[model samples]
Target: MTMRRTDVVIVGGGLIGAWTAFFLARRGRKVVLVEKGVVGAQSSGTNFGNLRLQGRFPGQYPLSLRAQALWEDIEELIGDRCEFDPSGHLYIAFNDAEREKLEKYAAVSESHGLAIEHLGAADLARRYPWLSGKAVAATFSPRDATANPRLVTPAVARAAKALGVEVVEQCTVMQARREAAGFVLETADGRSFGCDHLVNAAGAWAGEIAQMFGEGAPLFPAGPPQFVTEPFPYFIRPSVQAVDGTVIFRQIPRGNVILAGYPRTAADPIRNRAPVPPAKTLAAMRHLTAVVPALRDCHVIRVWSGIEGYLPDMIPVIGPSMTTDGLFHAFGFCGHGFQIGPGVGLCLSEMICDGSTETPLDPFSIARFRGAVAEDEKFRREFDLPAAAR
Candidate 1:
């Protein structure tokens, strides 16, 4: 059996793992990133790619804002733009309830230093004439953006490789255990890796790794169904979503309108499948047309989904493991991992190299699940929580 040693072994090649490897390598730490499949072939590459700031969990603003700054300067950091666009994000309200939600969200966002523009019905109609008349009010966050999820993980992996990090693809870690010296990971292909520190960024499959170390979380696997329409004349400039959470869409410069549906589809981690239901597709189409009347006739070209980990609380685990030493975790992103990938990587690197980070991560600690994790209100609304969590 071939055996190798490194300063850090990151099990998972998704965005968080790839970015962590890049940052760790930049800090002169010998790192090896292992993936069961090709890099970014999972949720990291399949998400809707919204870098939204207007409606995020208030506690995540610091990390999310830091991540947006990294994305804005992506070319300087990774030498690739990954089709990132700061075209803004528009949240529209269809009724009084949704308008109130938007107002609360905008206030919280403003408190976090995010600039928000509130638009009344007339202003929304005048500014976005293509919008349907059903939109009663709207909020626009100019700094929120979108990017090509299909391109981000691989590009970041390449950057990490360029910085002397070893990226091992299609190699699954069959066994991982703590040893006297550090942590030892055995791969499916009869290879062994020894590292002083271990990082579990394995996306939906990270729960298995955490369980192996005596820390288990109610991590459910699921994904949002996504679809893309055939190219049309470019018109919509920013990513847009209804405050009621039925649909979200954006028109790329190439004129293809990509959208994601709500009430996430169930995913099977063992089978590696996240199928987009045909009924969901039709419902999403109707919702999209209701938001933007111009898309009523656009033919959908393709549909897809990827597996992502969801916690009952709708937040992620992003700190040192409570059960073991020299171990860290950053998984269960619920479907919002793309924008904060870079910031998560940077924070993980700081925790490993300097033993702490300035960003507030106490809310994401693994110890929070020691008893019963109270399900977040959004989690109950957005996901069909597993019976175990309920």
Candidate 2:
């Protein structure tokens, strides 16, 4: 076997992995990134690119705030093109319950430094006359934005390459182990690499890698169904989501409306493909059409799904592995990893290179789930463990 050596080895090529590699390489670290397939080929590449702080979990607000700043300066810092649009975000409330929920969330979000403008039915109508009459109230975040997922991972990888980061694509790590020198990994194609630090950013397959080191996290694979309509007149300006979260849709500059809302379908990590059911697609269209009546007459162009890692608590497992020194993990973003990908990467790089990040990551530690086997067993009674691959 051919042996190679590096200062750091990243075991995933998603946005977090790619951004981590870019940050490390820019800091003059010798980094090697390994991907089973193309970078961003999975969830990172296939997600709805809405970057909003409106509906984030409270624990994530701090990082989300910092991430929003990073997104504003991404192109200048990374030297890669991200088709980012600062089109803001509009969250609609169709009824009294949803209106109350939106109002409450907006108040709490304001405390976190994210100012959300509460919009009444008249205000919503005055601002967005094209919206369907179902909107009773809304919240607007002017700092919220969108980006092209198809452009992020590859761009980050390219920028890292410019800084001399080694990218090994189409290589599957068959075996990995800790050694005195650090971590050693062997791929299926007779290749070997060793590094002093190992970062497990493997997305949906991250649980298996964590288990390789005796760290058990109940990470599950979720494949959300998404579809886009054929080109039409662009009317929707901001990426919109219902307060109930039953639907989310955004109109791109090219006039295609990308949308998703159905339940997450299960996907096999090895194959990395999940079939989108026709029935679910139809249901999603119906839900979207109800909000934007113009979509009722639009032609469906394409439908698809991608695998994402979801933890039981819906928070990410990011920070040092409990059982291993010099090993870190940054995966399991549930279904909302894209918006925080850059923040997670920056924090991980800081923790590794600078011993800590200014942003708080203590809440995302792996220790929270450590020695929780009994909890897992109990939780399994409600939701099967086979579905929770961790």
Candidate 3:
């Protein structure tokens, strides 16, 4: 196979891959970013762009706050509007069980020093008069924002290209073998490359890629279906989350409402080629109507679904693997990567380019599963929405 060389090679040119390429290339590292299909074709583009902190794990709060700070200036940094709407996000609650859980979540998250404002139903209604559905209490994070991921992915990718990073699209990675020097990589059409280091930002396919080096575990891919509504004027401001955060809805700059399903699809059909299920859309609509009756008049313009790699415990796997040399990873986002992807890229780049990371890597390490039990049930319980709560 023909061989190429670079200081670093990145697999999967989605939000994470492109961001890492941008940071590393900015550092003057010769970088190559590879994508099997169009950029942001998977979870990066498919999920609701709810950049919020209403219900993130406490360990993730700090990174999210930092990312939100960066997102405030993302348009200026990328030279294009990703439609950064800093309209904030709200998490609503109605009952004892739900209220108790939300209060705990708010307390734990607030302990992280986030500026979370709690509101009763009257204040919530006064703030968002459109929310006529059932809810007794709410919490808001003004730092939460939303963006058009489709536009942002390609835009930042263009920036990476202009910065001298080589980005290859529609090039499938067939095999990856660790070499004494670094790694010898191959593409589907027989093209090959030798790099001093590699970043496996391959999303759902990262675990599979990691196996080529006999280092990473085969990750579980969770496939979730999502739907978007037709254009509606002045509908939703900040993204909205269920008290337990099952259903997340946010309107894009173009005025289309994006509604997330309750029971997120799992990693079955490795890749999906069908429109979102009718039942899924209907379920999301029910949640929307219950929260914002104004949505009852809106029409669903489009529906789509994509699979993302998931770990057993539902946390993302980020950082270098223990078994491999000069290799790093950022995958298994399980529907939470879009907002954190860029900061994750920065952390990965720091780890790879500087031999250290200032960001805490404990919560995202791959080793969390070495001797782990089936903790997904607990993870689901901890983060599961009250509506979906069994």
Candidate 4:
């Protein structure tokens, strides 16, 4: 088949790319959604599905709130159920230092218009007696929830196809450069595609593409390991996390739990090998037992992993490619983009289709890091985990 052209070509068909396709196609733009692997086969299909608003940075909370509302009605928008849960979040705190951080977070959260309640250890123990005695305090935000990432991702891709988006799978974009008319993209398969604009949503591998532009930034990639338990009676509601802050476990409707945390060896960025390790799995399981003893008896059924993009700042990069015209990037989600995918798609579509984005996209732009903004650098220090997570 002879290669064709389109108004836009999204170079990654994960939820961010797929949902962007959904919005653009709805606006009458011819869209080509290309993926290196199957659609949503990376971070979109893996990782913990915590659709949360709590713990977001001050400048980021409002956007997260907007995304949360969009997620509430995503089923109606996409004509497919996203399996969004609304059981809220509990930020566990183990000791004075961590508790102090949560206390500061709670204040910052309130100032930003989010409703989070501070709870002492006794209160936390009374509310959910299953929490291990190690948890000294907690901050509860009633708006967070967990969903099925594996299911929601493929569903979003199908929804985009239904909306007239041409999704191409297993098509690797070997090289991309600017053209006067648009962006010229040639695939590893010896096919060519032209687009009025380009969006780089290739999770983990986005840096590989960004480096092509000669851009330098602290873009770290990691294939974090995680696991899930065999279905059992549902003893947990919402997500149960430890105050010790080592583990995060969320249960699905099927009564199975998802796990992610510090590892014996954090996967290197360049190599970026992805597969849940048994050591990380066991660590998460042990941490889960310490947080909620009830989970100790549940047998784990599967362990898996995916490489996620991160900037030292911990916020996503959502704006246009500064040096390249007809190019935009939407990687480096830092593991939080899934909950905000709908809003991100809408934001990117507005920018790509209309040439201007509505939200406060300035906060996530790559240009900020290069200049004196340095917010990303500060965030990296504040949210630093131990070597296990690094």
Q: Using lDDT as the measure, which candidate wins?
A: 1
> What C-alpha lDDT, on a 0 to 100 scale, does residue 292 get in candidate 3?
86
Per-residue lDDT tens digits of candidate 2, residues 74-189?
88977754889999999999999989988888887898988788899899879888888899999999999999998988998998999999999999888888998889999999
Which parts of model 3 are misplaced by more than 4 Å?
A: 266-275, 377-390
lDDT of candidate 3? 0.79
**Global lDDT of each model?**
0.93, 0.85, 0.79, 0.78
Error of 2 at 75 (Å): 1.7
Better-scoring candidate (lDDT), 1 or 2: 1
Worst 10 residues of 3 by lDDT: 381-390
293 in model 2: Cα distance from truth in Å? Answer: 0.7
Least well predicted 10-residue stretch by lDDT in candidate 1: 381-390
Candidate 4 residue spans exceeding 4 A from truth: 263-265, 268-272, 371-390
- Mind giving the per-residue lDDT tens digits that candidate 3 earns over 1-390? 558899999999889999899889888899999998888888787777778776777788767777777678887777887877888888888766877777888897789887888888889878889987488888888878888777888888998898999999899899888878889888988889889889998988887787776666546555566788888886677888886555778877677888877676544434445245677788788888888887799998888777676665667888887778788888887678889877887887888889987878788887766664364653464322342321
Deviation from native of the Cα of residue 235 in model 2, angstroms? 1.2
Clashing pairs in 1: none
Per-candidate TM-scores read 0.98, 0.94, 0.93, 0.92
Which digits, one per residue and each the tens of the lDDT, describe model 4 over residues 268-378?
545546655566677778888888888789888888777677776678888888788767888888878888888888888998878896578778887766764344543
TM-score of 3: 0.93
